[model samples]
Each structure stands twice: as C-alpha cells, then as structure tokens.
Target: MLKLSNETKVGILTVVGITLLVLGFNLLKGKSLFSHNKTIYAVYKNVNGLMPANAVQVNGLVVGSVSNLEVKDKDASQILVTLTITKKIDIPRNSVARISSDLLGTKTVQVDLGNATEYLQSGDTVYAATDGSMTDALKEQLNPLVQKLQGTLSNIDSVLLTVNAILDTTAKGNLQDAIRNLNATMRNFTHTSASLNGMLDPHNGNIQKTFDNLAAVTGNLKDNNQKITGILDNAEKATGALANGNIDKTLQQLQQTANNLNQTIAKLNTTDGTAGLLLNDKKVYNNLQYSLGNLNKLLEDLRINPKRYVHFSLFGKKDKTKPLPSDTAAVQQ
Candidate 1:
C-alpha cells in the first residue's frame, strides 16, 4: 500500500472537485463533456426580452443556448443572434426560429422544424419570425377601438350640447304656454270623456243597442257578401257593355258637339259674322248712338211743344171754326 501525505490527498481532492465543477459547467452550457458545439445564426426583427445564455429549444427540448446578439445592419432593420448548440441536434435548413416565453415568463429561443430534407450546417442562418408580445397585441387591438371611442364620445358631447340648447330654448319660450295648453286640453279631454262615459252608461242601453245593430248589419252584409258580389259583377258587366258601345257613341257625339261649338266660336271671332260684327264693328255702335240722339231730341220737342201736337179743351165754346192747315202742304211749302 502507498502512503499518501495529507497535503497530497487535499490536492487530489481539489483536482477532482475542479474537474467535476468543470464538467457540470459544461453540461449546464448544453454541451457534453467532450462534444463540440455547432454555431448557428438566428435573425430576428425584435429579440423581445431574450438575452445571452438563454436556452434554445426545439419541440420543448433544450438543444442549445443563445451566444450573442448584434445588429447586422442599421439600415437593414435586422438583428443577428448567434447560438451555440449541440451537434447531435439536426436543425433543418428551412427551420424557423423565434423568441418565446415560458409560462413563468422566462423567454427563450425556439426552433420550428420546417419541411426540409436536409439539416442545417454550421454557421447557417435560421430565419426568425417574431411573435407579437401580449402588450403589443393588446395595443394593436385597442388603438383603433380607442380612436372609435374618442369619436363616439365627441359625437355624444355634440348631441348632448344640441339637446341642451334645444331644452334651453324650449324652457325660455313656448314650453310653459305649451304645458298650460296641454293641461287645459287634457282637462277638457277628461271632461269630455266623463260626459261621453255618462252618455254611454250601461243604464242607457243605447250604445249597446247601437253596437248590436251595427254587428247585426255587419253580419247580414257578410252573409250577403257573395250574392252582393255576384250582383255587382253582373251590374258591372252590363255597365261595361253599355259603356263600351253606347257610351262610346255618346262620347263621340259629345266630341262632335264640342268641335261644332269650337267652330262656332271660330266663326264668331271672324270679322264678317254677325256676332263678330257686333263685337268688332264700330259703325253699328255709331248708328245706334245717332238713333238714340235723335230719339232724345224728338222726346225733348214733344215735351216743350205738347200744345202744338195736342189740344185738350174741357169747355166747348167755339167762336170761329178754321180748317187745320194740311200737314203735307205745310211740310212741302
């Protein structure tokens, strides 16, 4: 048996302990004790709370860890993140990578195996599709709603102001008068209704009898409806026949009469017709005026010299009798 010094035993124990710590650290880094790490690239628009040393997973299995994050090009609007993963995992070429969060709110990089036959080689770029965070999604959904709510509030304010103005105007002017008139109208209506109720009291029996009579008349009309319809149909057919033949002839006669009247009116408007002469001729009016003037002059001569034309003697005392001058000789001489 070899004898070991205490210092040598402590040194050996320290070496073993250091070796175990190294192996544990490598295991925690997602690397086997002797396995090599494969470098892969992940491109993202937003890292979204991801950092280095965060685990990379594929189908919920830990495969790698995020190594670095760097902006590839400021103008390109992209971020390039590098990852060191286990060589045993075969990431497909068309695989998509994304940053996701656990239920406990820890974020990590996740790989989605795409439909590709070949696997991803070292330093291959994995296209990343960034998912909107809960906050981002809520903002996206609520922004338009907030805008609509703002517009609705503005419209409601406008409506309220308009209603207020209308109420103010109504209260300032005709509202009281309208209320008084409405009250008076309501009172009058109440009185009239009371009077009508008294008039239609059950003790009177007149209203009930009238309604009963009306119902009976309506029932009788309903019973006679088909017969009345048949009679009306027959009367309508007869009237239609009469209107189609005799009424058409009568309308033709009336049209002819109207045309005759129109022609007569046209003739009366002519200058040579008797009515047209009466209406349009000035010589007839002048002759009438001259005849009227002569008649008036003759009437005046008769009124002034009535004794020359007629002599009336109450007493018959004749001293001499002389023959009246011959009327024709006096006129000619």
Candidate 2:
C-alpha cells in the first residue's frame, strides 16, 4: 500500500464513519440499504398518519417499508405513496394497499391480496385505501344506533303524550279495574296451573295410575304373546283352508239355492204352481177346510158309537139300535 498523508487518512476515515453512521441509522429505522426489493406506487386520499419507513405488511407479516409519500394534485387532496417490498412474493395488480392504524396509533400499510393472475411489477401502482381511525370507526358504527335511539325516544314521547291525554278520571279508573281483573285472572291461572301440576304428579296422580295400568296390560300381553301367536296361527290356517277350499263353488251353490228359493217364493206369491195355488186360492182353502171339518166329525161319531162301526159277539146275533138324532143329522149333512 502507498503511504498516505495524515490529512488524507483523516478525511477518508471521516467519510467511512459518516457512511457507516448513515447505514446504521437507516437500519434502525427499518430500511435495508442493500435489500433486493421492488418498488411499487399507491395513491390515497389520506395516509392516516403513515410515514416513510413505516412497515408494509402482508397478513401482519412485515415484508417491506413505505419508501416515500407526496401529494398527487395541486389541490393536495390525493397523496401518492411509494412502497418497496423486500419479500420475493407476487403481488397482484388489483391488490389493495390500505393504511391502517393500530390501537397505539402507529400506522402501517396492509396489503390485502387479490385473486388476479397478473402480478405487479416494479413501479406498478396498487389500489390504495385508508381504514377509518378508531374514533372514526366508533362514530360510524354508532351513528345508526344513535338515530334509532332518537326515533325510539320520539315514539315513546308521543305515546306518553297520547296516554296522558287519554287517561282522564274515568279512563284511569277503568284501567285500574282492568288491572285488578288481570291480576285476578293471573291468580286463577296460577291456581289452575297448580291443580294441573298436582293432577300430573308422578307419585299419587290418576294419570300416573292410568299409565301404570296401561303398562301392566302391556306386560300381560307380552306374557301371553306366544299363546296369542299360536291362536293367530290357527285362525290364519283355518282361514287359509277355507280360502284354498272350494269356497267359491260352495258360495255359488248357496247363492243358486237362495235364488231358487226366492223364485219359488215369488211363484208361490203369484199362484203360478200347484203349491202356489194351494197357498193363494181362497176357494180351495175353503173346500179343504170343509173336508177337514167333515172328517173330524166322522171320527168323533165313530169314537162315540163303537157298536155301529164294529160288531163282535160269541153268537152271530144281530144287535140293532136306533141311531142318535145328532148322528143322523151329521150323516145327512
């Protein structure tokens, strides 16, 4: 190495010291001097306290830092921010860089990833957004609730005013009476509920006893299940035999017999046969009645005068006596 003067050595040492100091200060402020990072841009209406060197996060992981911020328009209404991402991750073109603040009021740019296949390149502009501050968010959330409360208060005020207007002496008395009746009704309902509870008591209730009886019946049925099954099997076999037998032929014969009987009865009713004529003709009935009466008289006379009907003696002696007048009259008739 060449020998250097004291002034040159001192100047070089001072320059090195200054550079090292600058690097250390930037590192402490979350900036890497020799980082392999890409630069992207975002425009926002407000940064919400975002500053240079603030952390740029993707899903809460710090991947880079905000590099710069500047106003975009002459009116200073929009701000343009520069971001440098050190992480070698693809950020989509439609990704949002939202400036969000923590509870401690420190702000960072949170990248909400999008589903675009085309990714951002160096100097690309991402969509920018600003999350509401804590106070602003609370105000936003409470606005509708406050309005609802106001409306409810107004309705309550109107109701109270109308009630005050309507509640005169008689109406107040009627309301009191109605309240008393409601109380009485409530008491009655409570009593009825108590009675129902007692009636439904498991220990000493009729319903419980009925349920026990029903359970006992079911138990009895369960005990006789085999016998009942056997009876049912016998009944089924009997019915099957009847079904497999000539039941249709038997029924047809019975139906034919019944039809013949009905036809015979109809013919009897119309005097179409001898039996029908005997049942339906009055002259034949009268003649049969007269013949039966005469036969009965003749049998009665023979019973009374047995000597006239039969003669039996040891000697063949003829014994004759004058017949009775009633017998003669009967014979003449």
Candidate 3:
C-alpha cells in the first residue's frame, strides 16, 4: 500500500466532499444529472403552496420538478416559476401548468398538454393556475357559515339581554300568573282527554255503534245506488221532456179545448144551437112545460078510466057506449 502525503490526501478529500455535496443538492432539487431534461417558465399571480423540488407531473406521471421561483414583476404580485421537464417529454403548445395539493397538503405542478400538433420549445412560457387544497377549500366554504354563526351568537346575546331586562321587571308576576293559567289549562285538557278516552275506549260500544251505523248507511247507499241512478234518470227524462216542448204541447191542447168550450158557451148564450135554444129561449121553455103538463093529465085519465078503454062484448047485442070529450075535459078539471 502506498502512503499519500497530507496535502494530497486533503485535496482528494475536498474533491470527494464537493462531489457528494453536488449530488446531494441535485437529489434535493429532484434532478438527475445523468438524464437529459428541458426547462420551461410559468407565470402566475399566486403559486399557492408550491415550492421548489415539488414534483411536476403530466397526467399523474412524474416528468419534472419546480426548479425555481421568483417575482416576475416589481410589485411582487406575480410569480414566475421554472419547471424542469424531461427532454423526451413532448409538451404541446397550449399546455397548462396548474399548482395543486394532495391530501397530505404536498403541493405539485400538474401539466395538462393540449391536442395541438405544435409543441413547446425548451424556453417557452406557460400560464400558471392554482387549485385550492382541502384546508383552503374548507376555509373558503366555511367563511360564510362562520359569519352566520357569529350573527346567530350576537342575536342570542341580544335575546339574553332582553330576557334579563324582562326578568328584572314586575311583569314577572303576570308571567307567573300566565304560567299558572297554562298549568290549569293543561290540567283541564288532561281531564278532557280522560273523559274523551272514557267515551271512546275500545271496550265501550258507543264509538263502535257509530262506526257500525255509518257502515250500514254506507252499505245501504251502495246497495241502492243503481235504484237511485234509475230514479235520477227518470227524473232527467221527464225534465228533458218538459224542456223539449211536451208541456207546451199539453198547454196548447188544453188551450184549444178551452177555446172550443168558450165557443160552445157563446153559442148557448146566443141561442144559435139546440142547447142554446133550450137554455135561453123562454117561449120554447113555456111550450115544453105545457106539453109536459098535458101529457101528465092524459096519463092520469087513462089510469082512472081503464074500464072504458078495456070494454069487451061476447054476444052481438050492438049497444055502443063512447066516452065524450066533455066528460074527459070535466075529468081533467
């Protein structure tokens, strides 16, 4: 074994140490010195939790890392971040760089390559975007809820103050009185409920009888539904007949009959017919009365002198005895 001098040993150690340091620094920046890569720039208003050495991925595959970050403008409102991508990765012209975080809050840069045939060069620029992490998202969403909770708490405090002021007044007596009234009302309601329960208890037949009667009525109605429908149909038919001039025809016929009767009464009153002559002519009436009186006298004479009418002679002794007109007249008188 050859022994080296101290200066030479120190020089060799320094070179090895510098090499290790360079390798460590490259590893910390997520860089592989052995592999070829390209660099691109992205400008953003906010990088949100992005840091150097964070993985730059395309479609969830690790392609590069965030190399460096700086303020693009003097106002420091805009940040320009450098991304070192693999040389073999062909990024399209319209690619987008977005900063996102995982569930562990580890930030990353995700590249969404467009479908354009034109590709981005090594020193091309990209527009930067940010996606809120779980914490930031929750904070943004819960901000209104927090404000509403604060308002609710403030309202509750005001209500408590008002309630305290109310309790400090002599109206507490009225409140207590109202409470007592409410208790009394509650007791009365309890009694009413008990009484109602007694009336409607399952063992009691009153409610059942009512239900049975209702059921019976419903059954009767159901059974007689066709009969009722028939009656209604008949009534509708009658109403339709009345509405369709049947009643009018009846009234016309009645009117015609009444007119005929009125004409007959006029004829009777004017002595233009037989009934009219008999009812209105006094001379004919007197003649009828005299004829009836003469017929009655003739009938009476026949009944009294039946022997004169029924005379019989068996032998031929021809002695004829006849009734005289004067004797008949005298008898009539």
User: What TM-score goes with each of the models?
Assistant: 0.49, 0.45, 0.51
lDDT of every model, 2 decimals? 0.81, 0.89, 0.86
Candidate 3 least-lDDT 10 residues:
316-325
Strongest candidate by lDDT: 2
Tell me the spans in candidate 1 whose CA falls farther than 4 Å from its real position.
3-6, 16-22, 25-29, 34-37, 43-45, 52-63, 67-80, 87-89, 92-94, 101-106, 112-119, 169-172, 175-206, 209-333
Which of the two, 1 or 2, has more lDDT? Answer: 2
Supply candidate 1's per-residue lDDT for 92: 79
As a TM-score, model 3 comes out at: 0.51
Model 3 misses residue 127 by how many Å? 1.5
lDDT, candidate 2, 1-333, per-residue tens: 999999999999999999999998877666677877798999988787888889999999999998788888764778889998989999988899999998899999999999999999998999988999988988999999999999999999999999997898989999999999999999999999998888899998878989999999999999999999999999999999998999889999999999999998899997778787789999888888999988876777676767777978788886665565566897899
Per-residue lDDT of 1-333 in model 3, one digit per residue for the tens? 999999999999999999999999988987778887789999988888789999999999998899898997675788889899864889888889999998788999999988889888889997678887788899999999999999999999999999988986587988998899999999999999888887787667578678878999999999999999999999999888779867877999999999999998889898888788889999988899999978876766566655556766688454445565646778999
TM-score of model 2 (CA atoms): 0.45
User: With candidate 1 superimposed using the best TM-score fit, by how many Å does residue 70's alpha carbon deviate from the native?
Assistant: 6.2
lDDT for 222 (candidate 1): 100
Prediction 1 global C-alpha lDDT: 0.81
Q: Give, for candidate 2, the lowest lDDT window spanning 10 residues.
A: 318-327
